[model samples]
Target: MIGMSLLVRLALLLPPNVPQIPVLCYHQIRDWRPKDRTADKAYIMPPATFRLHMKMLADSGYHAILPDELYAHLTKGTPLPSKPVMLTFDDTDGDQYSIARPEMAKYGFKGVYFIVFNNINKNKYYMSRAQIRQLSDEGHVIACHTLTHPNIRKLKGSDWAAELDVPARKLELLTGKPVRYFAYPFGIWDQQILPELSRYGYLAAFQLDEPRDSAKPLLTVRRVIDDGRWDTSTLDRYLKHGFGHK
Candidate 1:
């Protein structure tokens, strides 16, 4: 473990010219309802729109890569597929399993599911433990979101264990694999927490649209949220803008 940590520290010092890979963060994958707030609709993707996004990606030859491939590419200077993109779901919504999974499967794509551990089997709208485990078994990466989706910037002391360590252990048990990646709740993080994340054995952590920490780029890996309102053309533009290619 010490040697691995030393390797990571050495890798962290490398120039950040690693190929630009677009990582899309998604939330609920269901259609909007009458009760849905206007602001909340940004995160609630309708089924048809979601399908179109997948179709576009597939048609455009975008290969969905998982966390391990991404880590290797960034740290060890490994080569990626012709058009590598990462589809990451946050918050463990039930629709991600019921809807997003099959849609991605059609394109022979896999995704990273960042789970809120406390919500499993407890919240009606969230995914159950069985569903999460199945995703992991099916080769999709199961990563940590947090215990309760709290803003990580406010956490202190044992709060870190509750949010990071405990949940990560629970997820590993459920998935029968190590949880080595994390997505910050509400895409918020602090520099002080980067070392804490490393101490907890995370290889990397993701945040939404934030400039990466120059010295610790792995911990602050950036992602862009796939808004519910986007059309196929909008997705194409954003992909090009974010990754410098279509």
Candidate 2:
């Protein structure tokens, strides 16, 4: 441990460069799920594995910045030091409120949680209002996941306005803090429809695409992750070296 500390201490003396933020995207926290059968996909990570990943980041000398902070750095062209990262969760599942939040708190990092407002009480699979508030009070961003998880590209005019704004307003009513960010339902916010995002007062939006190597596009920022099928070595490689794998 002393040698590892000495190594990090030495590395910190290096020069500044672009912050390669591997914004890790996650959902549904339960017992471990094996990598899916169809392809090399990055999706649902179990709560325990998520803990290991956070510990790994901390040990490797990475800082877990929030989505808004990352946006500010990228937009302002401010480079993060070596191994900068932002951890994020979407859908605002109840399990995230129950399991993931505590584990992440243990690691001293808070994630940006995008939620579907309509399911706060109507559905068992999603988070309830009280649970959502507790998470916000704990310091995580409970941003919007739209009212009903629609494709923003397909909708226009009032539909677009409603999809984007109402949930944010709902979150505001619930938590008393203004909602400042958003995430597309399936990483499907196309370029032609970006103006509506501004109409609803969003400062930044995220997409669960590949790792962002260069500067990010305004509407869609990129991220990478260590999901199922990615063992510890693969996870380390993806975070420290490669772009991303499916």
Candidate 3:
């Protein structure tokens, strides 16, 4: 499946003119991060706030597309709405399975979750296999972020492939489904790494960098890192650019 996909993408590469889609990256979904913990502040958000954001998208007439829609938009020249929002989560944090889903459910929206194999809930913060399986069955696209969430820009050869293949195989074996997406940890990427990325069978890849051209996008695309630091104001900036920046 992966080899064919790489060939297809390479065969399609040409002069640009594709419309951009916005993908929003999020971490933890907490009502409030305890002020005492510096890490918690960056990793958490109030549940009510997330609800508001989803409502904002719906109320503003935005449509959230699934992985396939994104694929179509890029590869088939499919058209999407003016405000197409993609909600994505990094790490298989348990709160997202239990808390975030319910909040997003209010708006009838879903997101793609990137899970790190090594961090599957050894601590109080991570998610368990059951929770991960349940969430995957509930319609969210469970994606890979490598085992242990290593920075791939520094990895070489088969070592890098294992980082990706481990979770992809694990998730697929557990879910009995194909794991098709991958999110690069910390938005770090090396363009040279893309060929291997394709070799691994990922249908699409995401990062923190926006595509240089909207028309002819690489399978690996950039998303806006959404957090409490910037409210709807930051999203508005992406909207203005006529690109799916967030």
Candidate 4:
């Protein structure tokens, strides 16, 4: 595992001749609380900062693509836009409907949201089922996160089945379109589940960091977490620096 991890890190160092599409992973697009000052603030991407990101992308000619488009590019050798990017929001937070959608629309962009089916419409923090459907109706891709957002690696048998299959079934019923992609809960994954993912008819799956398998693309694809610290200039530097850990 250590050797594989090292190989993946080294592989990411080489510059890609093709356009290296960045799948930006975000959680909350809302204000940070004073109590969360000492806590992990990466999940809370401030609305103004998010606006700056959208503005920067728009100004720089970056266009967001759906997750399925990303899958097609990776698997079928399909061509993508000159400056392809994918904006993926995990956990289907209510602020996504309330804040991020409007902010993205300002740049005429659509993002993919991975929803937790069990939490939908059940709490103030989560987007309701109707709101998720509305996003789908408006062209945002609605994908499955899981039923209860449990770490799949820790689950087995029926527990694993419920985690992987149930939400996907419900999502398909909600969207009317096939649920083509998935994002791992907490960015946790096991390659053993890849076969099951294929069985579920998922084109690809995403994780928070670079994937271990570059030989076979898009099973557990890489994504960069858009924490609150990013601004336009810093982001340019980060991408220019091979998106490697600084």
lDDT of 4 by residue, 1-246 (tens): 012233333332333332356778889888888888734577789899988988988888888898767655654568888677889999989998899999899888999999999889888999998999999999999998989988787877787668777888899899897776788999987767776776566666788775445433456667888778777888766555644321
Q: What tens-digit string does per-residue lDDT give for candidate 1 at 158-236?
A: 8888898899999988888989899999999897788788778888889988777777778878898898988999999
Per-residue lDDT of 25 in model 1: 90
| Candidate-wise lDDT, in order | 0.87, 0.69, 0.73, 0.77
TM-score for each of the candidates = 0.94, 0.80, 0.86, 0.87
Instruction: Give lDDT tens digits, candidate 2, residues 1-246.
Output: 012233223322322233346777787766643654434345666566777777777787877777667655655555665667777878768787787777777778778888888878777877888988888898888888899998776786689767887788889999988887788887765655555665565666777664321222434566554575466677888776654322
Best TM-score among the predictions, by candidate number: 1
Q: Write the per-residue lDDT of candidate 3 for residues 33-147, one digit (tens) a residue.
A: 3453755554566676766777777787777777777877766767876667888899778787778788778777878889898888678888998888877788877888888
Ranking by lDDT: 1, 4, 3, 2
Clashes of each: 0, 1, 8, 0
List residue ranges in candidate 2 displaced over 4 A. 1-20, 32-41, 77-82, 210-216, 243-246
Clashing pairs in 4: none
How does candidate 2 fare on TM-score? 0.80
Worst 10-residue lDDT window for candidate 1 reads 1-10
RMSD values, in order shown: 2.1, 9.6, 3.0, 6.2
**Top candidate by lDDT:** 1
Better of 1 and 2 by TM-score: 1
